[model samples]
Target: MRSGGLKRLGLVSGLLAGALALSACSTVGGDQPQQAGQDGGQNASLATKLIMGTPNPPPLSEPVDTQIKRDCPPVDVLDGAAAFRAYATPGSADPFDIRYQASIADTARECSSLGVEAAIRVGVTGRVILGPKGSPGSFRLPLRIAVVDEKGVPVYSRMHPIDVTVPAGQTQADFPHIEDGVVVPIPANRFRGWKIMVGYDPSGATQTRASRAR
Candidate 1:
């Protein structure tokens, strides 16, 4: 499994330690709510949803352009912006019909004095059954996953490029991706309203069209 680093997010003083320690938290499965607030208050849990087959999550508090600049990784060493633009463009021809989609199969969380840390581990799976041609060389699936509060404020977001290898004569692939160390501040009263979302990044062109349509 390939690993990508999370760009450290700015947080209030003193809470960073708790968030940092999340890297070593225990893992769990199933839908049971995990304990959050360190004060022994009512526990809270994160809700997970499928980005492709479900309703879209609330609009992001920050604009897509801003997110692209901060969370998106460079497509290449030079002409990085151009590379991203090209990659975001929906393919129009054969073999480009790779049905890309993902879901949050399981989740786990750990809490401490300063805040709560959750792991939004997911299974990114896809099949090339509809392709008019054969499998192309191995490629990276660019996935943008985010954790948002009830008011649509983002607690954590990252663009994880999962490398995929399609074996000869195979039509599908599965890549396990994890977004650990997701720091949610104390006062877990709102944890029940938080949600973890996974999906493709809105392409620059898509955003532009939406802007004009509005």
Candidate 2:
């Protein structure tokens, strides 16, 4: 009986020792990066690019083959055009008549030169706030994106209607608006006060909707 008990104890000890050795090999310092990766961090980097409103720029280590002599102008939201008030009654000026208000929160743009013309992608980040008469639902916000010269003349303009969906329990909704491939003649100098403008244009949205209705 004593011999059989000792033989069983020896077998158990061997198994435990092998398990410890295998575990130590798996946890070696050299394999830390691989072992810790939850699959990999590549998806996280991609998500960061979306939040940044553009693709990741080339790494500094990678030399540029050709550099375009151009610049991206600053984006602006004008005071009068930044906000739009939606009222229950058309053409109503009463404060109590406001159903909701949509406004621009931020803007960004990127520029690339295509030989003669510069291609730009402008982005507008905005929010819709609930007013006295507003309720949680979907809303269409009219966005006007334009490139204006120093004299406030629009060199290029485009109308973009963004959909904002506020959840059933939410009082507001945030939306991202991007207008891509806006081509313009390359300016002689980037600092010539060219402006990328974005704003709420209810008239433009209304006209588009009216046309669709017809």
TM-score of each: 0.42, 0.67
Q: Please give the distance, in angstroms, between residue 66's alpha carbon in candidate 1 and its true position after superposition.
A: 36
Model 2 worst lDDT window (10 residues): 17-26
lDDT of 2 by residue, 54-136 (tens): 33323223212223323556666655787777887878888788777876544455566677777776655445777788888
Please count the clashing residue pairs in each candidate, in the order shown: 0, 0
Model 1, which residues run further than 4 Å from truth? 1-130, 188-190, 202-214
User: Which segments of model 2 are wrong by more than 4 Å?
Assistant: 1-70
**Every candidate's lDDT:** 0.34, 0.55
Supply the global lDDT for candidate 1: 0.34
Candidate with best lDDT: 2
